[model samples]
Target: MPLVSPDNSATSSDEIMRYPFDTMRTVAATILSNVSIALSEHEIAWKKAQDYVQSLPDPLQPAFMDVLNKHQQRIRDSYKWQEDFAGALFNAIDTVSNTDSNISTSFQKIDNAKFTGFGHGHLIVADE
Candidate 1:
């Protein structure tokens, strides 16, 4: 069997196998873009949640804050774990090749930034 390029250039089977890398990048970028938009929406929702929590009656505020604190801490812990896991994955992938390593670097930066941003609940309304 032989592999042929559109330009009538002979291509290696390995090159053909690696062609999907570009496709994977395109797919990943599109997915990440969508996720980024969703994250923005998540931030809005968190702000609303914080506002609602803050609007509670003075006596109820303590209870509400307690619940929110517990849940938020759990969420942050889970995200921290996931961030570590993702960092490990990125490190493993980094060993693959130096070619287009920038792509991996970009992903690592985005992953860390997003994880840390969300983990800190930076979108939530500030307490007075």
Candidate 2:
């Protein structure tokens, strides 16, 4: 099956195909934004936890600090994964968008050529 039909109905079909990608891109961007906010909150909480551990007596602080450090590392790792995921999602969106644009442009050129004889010596004019 062709990516787009010669008729203009393909315009709507193109839009239909583009909808999901656009929606996914929007959702991914929103999720990434929320993740950033959550990461900031995590930093604040981690700092608070560290402060609380430091308030403990010197003998009690070391163990609590160690635990906090381990948990912070885990949180950082999780955030890194999320950042990587967002990067991947954005890349995919960009690739799809470029492909979609190229397809649309090609289809438009084909449509124009139908009326202009594809730049051959013979020209076909369309009736308005």
Candidate 3:
């Protein structure tokens, strides 16, 4: 039957079918490597925060996750955390890309901006 067909011949002829598990393997390796860097104290406090989060038992995980959430937001807020995150992120990418040609990551900062306005002098003064 001469019916609807695809020119997948050109694109897919030489291409290997990458299963979901393949991408997951790369991502998992990257995460683990980044965590190792984190424990070495080279990575940001956010990394440590992640360690704390992941170490928690599955049942009790979500409750204390707020602090990690805030830490990530604060990384956006602070220049220092931004720098640390950049370095660690790049290092992991480099390691993966160099050893494995299939894996690729272009680490680039889109923008780093602290949210909201400055201290409005509407302070509740401490009554000494």
Best by TM-score: 2
lDDT of 3 by residue, 1-128 (tens): 11233556755555544334445446656656665665455356657777877898987667668766766656545544544565665566565557455333212111233334435764233222
Q: After superposition on all CA atoms, what RMSD does each candidate show versus the true structure?
A: 21.4, 7.9, 25.8
lDDT of 1 by residue, 1-128 (tens): 12234454455443432334444445555555655565567567767878997898889878987887777667656555655554554444444445457777966666555342233655332222
- After TM-score superposition, the amount by which residue 49's alpha carbon in candidate 1 deviates from its true location, in angstroms, is 1.7
Which 10 consecutive positions of candidate 2 have the poorest summed lDDT?
1-10
- Looking at model 3, residue 77 earns an lDDT score of 50
- lDDT of each prediction vs. the true structure? 0.57, 0.76, 0.53
Candidate 1 regions off by >4 Å?
1-41, 96-128
lDDT winner between candidates 2 and 3: 2
Tell me the TM-score of each prediction against the true structure: 0.42, 0.63, 0.25
Model 1 residue 75 lDDT? 64
Candidate 3 clashes between residue pairs 3 or more apart in a chain or in different chains: none
TM-score preference between candidates 1 and 3, better one: 1
In terms of lDDT, the poorest run of 10 residues in model 1 is: 12-21
Q: What is the Cα-based lDDT of residue 14 in candidate 1?
A: 38
